[model samples]
Target: MGRVPVGELSRYLLAGRLSTNGCLTSFRRTPRSRLVGPAPPTLRPLRTFHAAKEQPDPTHQQVQTPPTVPLRKKLKDEAKQARKQGKKKSNADSQTVEGWELTVGIEIHAQLNTPCKLFSSATTSFNDDPNSHVALFDVAMPGSQPIFQTGTLIPALRAALSLNCDIQPVSRFDRKHYFWWDQPSGYQITQYYQPFAKNGHITLLARDGIAPEDGKSVTIGIKQVQMEQDTAKTLAHNDNTQWLDFNRVGAPLIEIITEPELHHPRTAAVLVRKIQLLLSTVDACVSGMETGGLRADVNVSVRRTDDPSQTLGTRTEIKNLSTIKAVEDAIIAERDRQIRELDAGRQISSETRGWSIGSTETRRLRGKEGEVDYRYMPDPDIAPLVIGSDLIAHLKQSLPVTPDTELDKLISYFGLTPKDALSLINIDNGARVEYFYRVLYSVQDMIAADDLDGEGADVKTYAALVGNWTLHELGRLTSSKAGPHGTVDLTFAPDGDCAQVPDAELSQLLYHLYRKHITGKVAKELLMALYLGELEDGVRSAIDTHDLWFKEYSLEEYEALVDEVLEGEDKVLQEFATSAKFPQGKLMFLLGKMMRAGQTERIDPANAEKVIRTRIESLRPSAA
Candidate 1:
């Protein structure tokens, strides 16, 4: 077909009847109009006389010729009608694209907690010499074949099973090709088409100011969990040169992707923290983010639910956000950038962006790549992984109670609040958390015993005091020290090092305070002294040198001291009785005045308050 000029148009020629403006109309080109153009060479004049055979043809067949229309004019009329329809449809579907919505899906690649790499037996230690841990298969040397590590699979399976995901009976590996400085082979062995597990959910304890929870419960659905080999790390230089570290290459990695259910950056971080906790609980991964053991690729998107016709806006992936705070900032900044671009009537580009930690902004790195771009194929060297029912049963039986389940038990069994249970369950060390529970229960026992001994004490009050003090104050103190500064002071010792204080001793101290044997302030001072290893080591009996220190001060001796002080300062004593507010700057203050009067005898504040009250009573005039 020849190209049509812009000015040329098309007209349709119809053989059937046509309807226009509710009227059937038919027309033909007039002979006078035909004269306007040059007549065809075959044109002939009308014949006056005709042969009988030609004249009889009208009776045999009634010949009819339809008007012919130009092809260009027909095309123009069809296009005009199409354009009108298009305008009407656009008006009906129009929407305010002022704010762009981004749909984000993150694929986190975390290094598996294994002693060796996935395809090689080389040590997976991070700080070893470059290529020290690389094997023939890791570097993809010719004739060196890949082998799957059973050790790696165990931890990965444990992680998946703990997340309530099914352990597939058969899983396979594939080779994903991409060029990079660190990867000597230019390809990585990973799983793409088929993963080991799929469709799971993780419940996270949302942090304050992040979601609707405000440090409450939130659930994020997990889309998929896959096992793959990690890529080698590259250290870039200022001159654009790169140093390859093959130690990380071929290391087992488990990638967990979440559904785009998160609305805020902080919510995503909360999900990450919960996963980290669960991974730690299962002993599958460490909680350290700085060492590159764990990293996340955060996908972010936005949309307004009211508009149905509008297409979803572009999505950007925040690459390798290791720190929780950085992940949050990256999401905020990326969301704002997308909204601004839409507001300015510019389309948001779908791309992968890198987060600048120092500047705290996101910068475009590369456009998004389709699945086919990676040229993924089944890994030829390794055979298909086949898991048996027996192995699955054993794994299920061996798995510990998940953090969420344990958290619920903690709340119900120990009467802990939701917030406290969440904090306690997320601790890095499960053993420590268990020990804290033990101490809490032991303290309750002591409170009950004190009440039975005619020394009334509130269990709930003391339990709150112990729980808060241990979680906040004591935890802070222990964590601040670079080394062991003192022995562990607990209300009860659980059959271990003498470093831990016994519960009986703690109960004794509380009893003494209730009996007016020591002031609340003095009890803290003695506890600190005991924790500093000041008492005789391994002295399990409560009435040892430590108890002797509290018992030595007699009530009579303390009273006598107060009496002498009052007699020595009779003028001040009278003023204290008569004046509403006596000046104690020059005379008497708190226990400091008594301590100054008698340094040889260490008079604690508890004994002092009792002695002072006694003296004041003796000085008061008789009521009768």
Candidate 2:
């Protein structure tokens, strides 16, 4: 019998070994020394038998060879070798954490700011009547199928490209099976095996008291991003029954999954906010927590960095954190819970947990399940999405400057500190900062054209004043009514709401007050009146209003007010004449008193101060 090579032995054994009857079967290449008989005719061609008279017949030597080893022994040896190799490799690479390392990843679900749903023509507007927007596909009724919408895909692609992710030309969709009262279909149509975009990163801003500089910074790596349909919402009742609202069903949504890179819960929270801002800046999504436009599923796994071989600790999914602060709180609470469990020699289980806003703690709802539990399978109705590069490039070109780039530009253009620029840019409604720049540029153009002189007016100071008023006072007014951080969507028209106040008028008001053409009190009063809608219709300039409101007084009227003050306070005049410090102290006091009296009579306070100063100077020279 021929011996087989070790690699070919499995094939021979699988075909069955030689039969017990004297029949050759499953003939294999046998080891040369293991031949048990005279050389076969097949072997005769390869080697000729030579006459060996003195050393016995060579044929006898060939016949004396032992039979091949049994197949069972060979199989056993192979198994032992495999086991040995596995053990050696495991010993070298396996790491152990004192406690299990929790492997956490996040899945963020954000609603796209589209005019319609993913698969229907229903208007995607909020606050609609329940079930009014439902289409046959949204309800998953019989004979209804999904159709691709370019509006949905374009925005998602723009976001993916902005994040620097590789767009998958062909992406598959699958049905994710789960039970929820709101979902009439019993499963959501989502992308599973393949997704649209993958492998991107984002940098999150860290909170104060955590770490300064780069200590608390988090860089989250994305696993994939997919376009999907949002599930309907359930309105709950006290008796465990629920009311279904299909208004949100089939809303176009982008689901972004992150790798298990976040080491701390706070980091996860911070990372989510960064992504939210990115989405908002592109107009891809609104990311409003109050409006349910954004939601996150945070998975947390804990493992010691020191141990490489130990399995990671079980992770819990923190469900549906709406606000950034809530996200941070949820993460910290979960970390503390897991750490306490490990300290007590208790193991953390893989489960889904909810955050209690009142107590700020995680409450386990149910055990987490693997992907198979969803029974994901390709959706038979929809075909693979074929994305072209041209569309992607166009979208990229249309995108506005990114937040990071805008931050740097703001710092240089507005002469703002790094911290202030960052703070301003982080705001979701920060378009006002951009508006301020537009106005500043207009002012600069006016200065260059010689329409206004830049001598008495400092551009930097004026810019700061405008930024502070917009960011602080105006922001407060609008936010008080709309919500915090909100501002009126102003159009910088000449006479429209939120129109730009003219720089010349502002400068002129300041100049008059400084030169005593108008009192400081009168200038402020006039400015407030104009701000409160006192300006005439079709008014093109603030200077006209300032000149119209300026009050002129005769020297006799001013002198009378000054004399009244001096008569009532002879000690002040005496001090002005005798004391060296009286000019700055007592003499200024007399001037202020006279200004007050003049202001009551609609006279300019600046004139009163000037007249009083001149009179006191004349008296002082005589007294000396």
Candidate 3:
């Protein structure tokens, strides 16, 4: 066979299944040394697994490499040592409240963007039908063993690194015993004893989407990040009957736990938003929380600031908050509830609660579960997840630029305002920023090739022009008509190309503006025409065709008028060409005559001189 269709292959084969001691071992991309038998010659390119049981099982290669140290570990150690050796001062933000201090933590459950579930080969898509993507292992059928998908491990590692978490060289999964409608298995497979990554931090800045007046520049410490499976969603009907959607069952998830350091609800909201942006930027997690890609458990407790006691108050957790706003509101509600309870001389109780729509009140779901409630044990089917230090180092060097990196480039290199740069960085998953850069560089190249004859273009000043057009003008045009996803047509072609504005047409518009061939008003008119199927030709010809060119003369018109002035000054042209550099005084004198002849004072004196120089060079012969 020449080639095999991907759909034709069974998911078991795609999952890299092997028979070892009558159980399934799911791993792929091995280093080729552990193969017990030679690979089939015909399907060597496809995934090949060994059935004989001599080699160890893992997520990938299991080299004898030590775990990579998290960057925050050293900083945490130093901070601890300093606090132990010296007196500690109360952190202002953490202990801000007078006579009352509210402490909060968050556990965010973000789904990894894997095509399939972690243990099963079932696709991880949201389907309406119950059990649409469930497999035997996902449903906990007897004698069904799980094979770990390597696709799940890479993104988790990337997210860990991005958040400054250390990767454990050897991480294993555990089983937490529970009985619920969602979990068909009595126990859930999770990482309890050894988390994948730990000891990370995410910093919230005062600007770039956050409020400047708040003046926040605090780093919230990350306690741990673990990998686990999601339970089925319990959907209830109008008749009091409920159905379990196993389509969402057994999906891969990363639980990011934060230290109880947040004191403000706004700050907690900002932290969740920051994590969403970071993980999505690195291609780790899906960005939208409303679509169930991510959710959070907001935990809060209130303690008396007047009391210097080491013991804190009872904390309550609001579970499965699907929106960032919900996280903020829930924390605020819980904190206020605790404070009120304390004011009435009542003790706060620990419980898990759910938030309602637009209300500051929370409904209790259950009492908080401790270790004894869910009997935690090691998962027998899956083996330890082994990762090599070499792979970690390579991935570190290959990490893509985050939003902060792009923001700095726009502000420092392009001289854009922070607000303007952030506007670009914060939209359409960075497509707006990408589009702006494309338009700018394309215009720069166009002008360099057309105007400078491949010489030094040096169009840094035009960046402001590009910024204004991209941020204000393009945005205005795109929002004029609402299309799919509440988007107006971007490409201005009425016949067809009425979707996104292509970078080339935008480059052409900017080029015309840069050369002053068309005024700002004319360019805006041309853009509207381009959007509305009014412009007949390209930006260059459209200006003249629509009688929209400004009073300023074109380069050709300026050169033609300069030729008339140079006709009477033959000796001037000869001396100007013979000299190593043209004299400034003589050039200005000639430029004045050229402007007078053209009857236009709108042209730049520098541009007028350029016309004169070119005309003079052409008049004189090229020397050998």
Candidate 4:
């Protein structure tokens, strides 16, 4: 029997080679000391001899190797270390609300804006008859092999590039096994093992009261973006049964997983919206949460500042959050729940949960599963995807300027403030941002082509005017419900009808506004009339019919209106005569009456004030 040192004991136990039969079976290197005796006694701490020994064997000395922990134990230890590090890092500088430091990571699934499904030729359009878009391959019919859609690849690539991912040239798919009613194949074909993109990052400028006035750039880490198929929709009936609508089955989807870097719910919500805007701008996905085109899974956890090196609190995964409010609300509720648990001395359970929009609370769904439970394996039927130079080039060309890039350009190019630029590209008006740019650039192009010169017709002013109207008035007309923040979607109204106003009419209205033909108010009225179909005749006809043109009254005409006001108001003239300090006060009072008497639009209010003041001064007696 050989005397194994204390450090070697961990290795032996981890290796599982120290059998009950008293034999060391697994060893990478032979020990310097050979086993020469029988079974040893109970192990104890090695004692050092203070007295000098003759020819002492150094091999018998207690030389300890770094303990070799078991693989599972090692992983657990590393996670424990990470949690400690995460807590320390979090407490070092993270913002804490309600005495709890919040940590959140969002996983978003955005349906690719593709005509067909990811692995089959089924239509990906929504609002079709139930099961109408399902193909044999979509339902996993026997002997039905999936053929990948090339169209779906482009959007994924575009999203990956826009999100600052390093696109892997060689990516493979794997089958994730799970038993669910919606998943017909009993497994999902996904790029789980090796995703198409990895290690990306997004810089989020906190808005919507997420940070200080000078909002910090919160850079969230993107873990990976994987291509996967959507499961079918399950509609529960009154008879305690369910019907499967496979229209969404096999639909192309990309899942973006972020690191646990988000600390505020508002910041997390804004980040989700920003990602949605980026995807929509690049034509990667529709990014409509209401239409089931986008979904988010949020992981929320909390810890304390006192225990900086303690493990992070258990996390709860809130699944399938369809709206931004849901994401924010769920995070807040979950974090509060965790804080309450901590305050009550209760342990938080790691579980999966569901959010009820009506109840506005997270309820337990099931215990969270480890990754090994999915049983991932490569799909033999499909080959690995190879993204070559040509495809990359094409994808790069196809992608529009990303949201951040566009925001920077708008701030620099148009001389707009960052807040104003962010307002245009905010998620609420994401879909309409391009339309605004189109109208603005069209005005720019016209100004260049015609070389127009006017008092208020500079490119910057015109661009600002276009942005204001497009983001404000036009957005209101196109949205079903306009709130203080603006609109989220303009494609469908409450009646399920498209709320799109004609871009041509909008362009014409902007032209009139730029050329100083109509005031901003008049332009708004014209837009409303056009949207309501009350003005069929184009922009000019609408303006002329409604008498919305900017009115310009001659100095003589304004003076006459002022005189009429003065004659009707003897009391005002008397007040001015007795005051003697300022005769123009009486004339200024009369100017308001003149403007209200059918000259509001006809006479410039400033010009009226000037003329009335001049007349009053001319009539004044010098020092009498």
> Candidate 3 clashing pairs?
483-487, 490-499, 491-500, 491-501
Poorly placed runs, candidate 4 (over 4 Å): 1-96, 206-209, 409-431, 441-456, 475-501, 510-525, 542-551, 559-594, 609-624
Which of the predicted structures, 1 or 3, would earn the higher lDDT when compared with the native?
3
lDDT for model 2, please.
Answer: 0.67
Question: What TM-score does each of the candidates earn?
Answer: 0.64, 0.64, 0.68, 0.72
Q: How many residue pairs clash in each candidate?
A: 16, 21, 4, 0
Cα RMSD, model 2: 32.8
- Ordering by lDDT: 4, 3, 2, 1
Query: lDDT per model, in order?
Result: 0.65, 0.67, 0.75, 0.76
**Per-residue C-alpha lDDT of model 2 across residues 1-624, encoded as one tens digit per residue:** 555456445534643233322224313334456767543322221112353434546675544434455557878899999988764332112222344444558889989988889888877867878888888888878988788777788778877876778898889888999887767788888888899998888766543212232374556688899988887878888988888888889899998999887655445666676677678778788555656899988887676656798776777898998887777667666776787887789988988999867454699898887898888999888888888888777887899788777766766766666666665555534555555555455555544555345454446655554455445544443445535323434343322124534444444444444434554456555555444456554223444544544456678877777778888677767777776554676666776776666655366555566788898887674643
**What's the true lDDT of residue 363 in model 3?**
83
Estimate, for each residue in 1-624, the C-alpha lDDT of model 3 and write its tens digit.
234345433323543323321212223323357757654321121232344434544765645544433435656888899987885333223223458777889999989989989899999977556777889988899999988999998899999998999888899999999898889888888899999898998877766444333475888899989999999988888989998888888899999999998877777887888788788778898655867898999889988876677577888999889887888777767776778888998887788989986875788899989898998989888899998999899889989897777777888888888888877665555566667777888887777676745565555578878888877887777563423332454532212222445667778988877877666666777777666655556666776676765576778878677768878786777787677765667777887787677755356666777777776667555675
TM-score of model 3 relative to the true fold?
0.68
Better of 1 and 2 by lDDT: 2
RMSD of each candidate? 28.7, 32.8, 33.4, 26.9
Give the least accurate 10-residue stretch of model 1, judged by summed lDDT.
21-30
